[model samples]
Target: MNNFTTFFVSGWHHIVDINAYDHLLFVMTLCAAFKLKEWKQILVIITAFTVGHSITLVISSLGYIPDNPKIIDLLIPFTIMITAISNIRNYGKEGVFSNKNVKYVIALIFGLIHGLAFASNFKVMMFNDNIIKPLFAFNLGIEVGQLFIVAIFTLMLFAYSKILKGEHLKWNIFVSGAGFGIAATIFIGALS
Candidate 1:
């Protein structure tokens, strides 16, 4: 019985697993949304996403609404494509908060949708013991996973910035387009 419980508990770890498609898409979208520089901007965007996801995740998990995992699964990819589009449009812009707040706002909104996707899994986990603690822990794990991926991406971009010097924008477009394409594929696949 104890082993079974431990196995079940371990499964919650996947909720935040960065390698997971949903979580990866969310992080990619957020990272691609804003031009990278300075930890403050990253913090603002990440915080907004976290707050948004946490709100909906907690609400849906608490039975505020019966969340449909399939719907959210599809929407998650759409959110990624939207964010990638936004990023592609805003490439090479300056000022993190000057009018870019709209993008972050969208991030927050999409974050909520992404949270709904998570709520499905969390709701199942709720059947176990100490629901609140596990839920909070899982959310924290997600944040950790997001931050880790963002940091790696940032570092990679910084390195490329130093290398290419000026061609980064072109690369950004290519990468963002790739992300959008991948997202679109996922969304379509989910729908079909």
Candidate 2:
């Protein structure tokens, strides 16, 4: 494969990998609160996350951010736990997160944490001579992977909405609860 394709595929698979699914779980929880109709808001939230991680990825790649695998591993699952709990708390009370600003801020902050997680591996793969192309391509691949995940999640929500009829909140709560459990497990593992 070509260089661009190699980098893109590597980045894409990095996020979507089934064995290492912290990223997937985080994205699922992040987008779980919104319905298909709220695509614009979802896009913004996802973009904010992308921007957060992209900034850190660049900084970390340049060696500006210190490596702390233990802290980052803990934070990765911690962020997921936070997002999942937030969704659970806001289950029926959609008004709580009516302010998009709060969501954006959360996404950005959590995205930074996630970026640090990404940076550990990213630093290993980066080339010193040509950082820009690979970095941009990698980030782009991540965005595309995120969009793909959102699309699948949106379809599942749509199906649930259609079949269950007004049970979207329950579905969100259930999924978020599961995510929280998974994240908690990972967090405990990290502590050990």
Top candidate (TM-score): 2
**Which regions of candidate 1 deviate over 4 angstroms?**
1-19, 92-98, 127-132
Poorest 10 consecutive residues by lDDT, candidate 2 = 90-99
lDDT of 2 at 94: 51
**Residue 32 in candidate 2, Cα distance off native in Å:** 1.1
* Cand. 2 Cα-lDDT: 0.86
Residue 152, model 2, lDDT: 90
List, residue by residue over 1-192, the lDDT tens digit for candidate 1. Answer: 453344334433443454566667567656754455556777778768877877886787667978676887788888888778777776666655335577568768877887786677667756554566665666566666677778887777776677657466665676678888888988888988
* Candidate 2 per-residue lDDT over residues 1-192, each given as its tens digit: 766777788778877889769999999999888877789999899989988988898888888999889998899999999899888786556564646788998899888889998787888887666788888888888889989988898888888898667587888888899899999999999999
Clashes of each: 0, 0
Itemize residue pairs with steric clashes in candidate 1.
Answer: none
In candidate 2, position 154 carries an lDDT of 87
In terms of lDDT, the poorest run of 10 residues in model 1 is: 3-12
What are the Cα lDDT values of the candidates? Answer: 0.68, 0.86
